[model samples]
Target: MIVFLAALLMILGLIGRMVYLMVFDAEYYQKKAEDLHERERKIKAARGEIVDTNGTVLATNRTVCTISVIHSQIKEPEVVIKKLSKCLGMEEAEVRKRVEKVSSMERIKTNVDKETGDKIREMELAGVKVDEDFKRYYPYNELASKVIGFTGGDNQGIIGLEVRYEDYLKGSNGRILTTTDARGIELEGVAEDRVEPVAGKTLQISMDYNIQMYAQQMAEKVMEEKQADKVAILLMNPQNGEILAMVNVPEFDLNEPFTLNQDQEISEKSKEALNQMWRNGCINDTYEPGSTFKIITASACLEERVVSLSDTFSCPGYRIVEDRKIRCHKVGGHGAETFVQGIQNSCNPVFIDIGLRLGTGRFCDYFEQFGLLGKTGVDLPGEAATIMHKEENIGQVELATMSFGQSFQVTPIQMAATVSALINGGKRVTPHFGVRILDKDKETVRELKYDDGKHIVSEETSRTMQALLESVVSEGSGKNAKIEGYHIGGKTATSQTLPRSANKYISSFIGFAPAGNPQILGMCVIYNPQGVYYGGTIAAPVIRDIFDNIFPYLGIEKDVEMQYTN
Candidate 1:
């Protein structure tokens, strides 16, 4: 009876103990652990470098230090506060508050420069720690700010290419634990342990540093000249879908990304205005594509075999689509012109007729096939899917406007990728920036793979379109886009903006060089310019400016047969 009673009592005691731990003692034990085992010094990992194709560092890390105070280890609190306050640019009261924090340790300041850190270390204050760390630094300041992006205090990527490849760029953070002596100083060689951090892998991209620089220079010049709200420009290797240079002018400095620089006179439009500055217009903003959209129309008509090169069309300035009339850009109309001539002239009436002949279903199909109905699949964030017409609701007026690059919205990237396909033997390619992933030792690990890009048009159709586009530069609207010795093929587009009413316009030009076998393709977009909104007059010149630098830089030799001095 005594033994059975003892066993029952012991079982009851265990239950009581469990209840105490689960209910009453849980918070207490957790607090004790935090006060003891949890007091650790975090060692921040170095963020990976972002390098251009030429191995020049675009984004890199620089050594900095983080200062912290452990309440239990701090012996002379007053001296600590006074010295740290001056060195870290913190008020004495703020330093005091952190020092008095009941937690195991408190962070006083981070990313302290070496000179200031050395000054603090010279004071030799107790309980204050000066740990080595890294800060993200952009060598070029404002250059490619939108492309390389910036990091938060935690070293996490927050914008641009930084955020897109955050996984590969953010290395694991390490930690160290040490026991404090009676004087509140870390006891040398006593109960110390560390877990070392591995640095992030390097990102090797195809963006040539020089090309990107020149592109930005031209974009800034055009933005200033036109007083446009914004401008977006992109250059690409048409054969492989590699974006050589992409620039959105009025870019902020990655080192000070929060700052805004624009002509807007508002003083207090803070947060919203700041976000607008970060927006990448190349892939985010949409426009009607204007006459530059003629490339798609021409390609579709030729692909469907609905229009022949010898076919002639007479435009008396406007065409009657059902009850409404749509006018061509040339008010007097292009009279009795060949199909190829119609394209070179960018004649709206001629394209409208071709659209009607192809019919609604086939036109929509061809549009979808050209990847106009979707995103360009560029290896970037926030790529917008195209806003397009539904297949079922095609009316005659909609078709007519669409035939001349109206009533449709596509991003600058979408247009660039599509145009790349047009000139690069009709193979649709997904635009990508990253070339390969490299280890810290600069050894290549993974080569980026791209979609082999399906065929949108026959090679013959591509050749035909290339010739027509070449004439657009040589004998038609895009004469200003001609670079001295390069055989450039191009088209100019000036699109009207619609809130169903706005009088604003978006001017753009798309072009390819060495028309015989296009190696490079480029496009530029200028938004809401004040006076002249013609792509031929405005955007074409900007493209020519970029080509002048990019051609020789890329070693695209000047044509001996076609040399014309600049």
Candidate 2:
């Protein structure tokens, strides 16, 4: 009787458990069964567009396709290989290798043209799969390649602004889920489930397309004419610090960033060469500013009252500073001249004397004050910091060289930003490119903000410096930069590279327009030009030619009263 009772209890417990599973756990088990037959594939989201301030598209995406193969679904291996190889223009052997691989899915090729992908899709060969994807396209090919950067096979940012703002530039990927049978074939009469991908936000930058084109044209012309190693041009608004254009000559094609732009054997092209080609010399590299640095020295001196514009000094070609004899550019010198003439002549002796008057303590103080000694905090990547002698290590000789823009190194962007400060009402602005971010509907998602700038010098000193730089273009070394009816102001630099004996020089010029109330500021740097490598001669003229075209296009009217004088 006891055995029979135990058997009955066991049967009753089994019945209760079956009822619970059928009723309470039915949904969960059903989902698990459905999941076993479901196959999921990913859909790539389209990357955002990059536009200029004028709404001109600089970097955009083109529809492409990714060709993949499902190993289990491929029944006719030889037929699949033949069709895929012919359609994809790939080797049959290669297609066969991937088709025979024991994997869920294998990618044959990505970035295939849409037309070709559509052709493959129409074949409806069981194993072959084509999905829409995006490939970054630069309409201008090589324009601003380094700054806009490029993406990798995974569609992730590689460098430049693309990588810098990756979060905003990349989008969320979606999925395509389909029901499949045991044979890995799509189940009949079943509809596929697709989750649409979300596209990235549009990035708007301060770069002006027209200005950039003109600047690039001028840079190419100068580089070809001078046979220089390279040339870089940067343009910005001194008042607001918006970089209008940045040109690095011999720019690599954004589409073919891996290929070297120079004439060299494929095997000889090293990674370093590619890096150098992509490098934006204007911010990534540093050099002695030479006479252009004189702008900083003069501004500091004037602010400190160490020297007045009318203060007179004698320059018999050189100055003796702590046993070191520093020679001026003009060996015969200007004999006796006021401080204004000294600046125009770029006299080393006059600046050295004034630097001595300011003293080492004051000179270092100004160096720190001028925003030199640090990065410009530009939006671009790989910005180099100014290389300087430590304040405590600076001596009479170091101070003298620093005064005339030597014995230290600063990136071109730093020089441009600091000079902008000296001329733009004493506020040191951060040089940047990003302007705003927008959604697909063109609504403002976020307006980018940068440092509003710190007050470095007084407004009075800024005005005085502006006038002094205007004299540099009007009557001094930078005369070649003068436009016929524009009140242009600038400083010229001819700095020698290291080892002194190498004799290689970088010719550069930093200039602004309508000097009284500065607007556009630009700098042209020509590295290692052949003969006639003076900044005033080669570099200054490049800016003049660019401004001549860009100024008119930008609707900057000429100053009717400002006349050119020989």
* TM, every model: 0.92, 0.91
Question: CA shift at 555, candidate 2, in angstroms?
Answer: 2.3
Task: Find the candidate with the highest lDDT and give its number.
Answer: 2
Roughly what TM-score does model 2 have, to 2 decimal places? 0.91
Tens-place lDDT digits, model 1, residues 198-306: 8998999989999899889889988998999888889999888898888998899888776544324546768678777888888877888988888988899898989
TM-score of 1: 0.92
Q: In candidate 2, residue 309 scores what lDDT? A: 86
List of clashing residue pairs for candidate 1: 292-493
Clashes of each: 1, 0
Q: Which segments of candidate 1 are over 4 A away from where they belong?
A: 1-35, 180-189, 260-269, 560-566
Q: Which ten contiguous residues of candidate 1 have the minimum total lDDT? A: 557-566
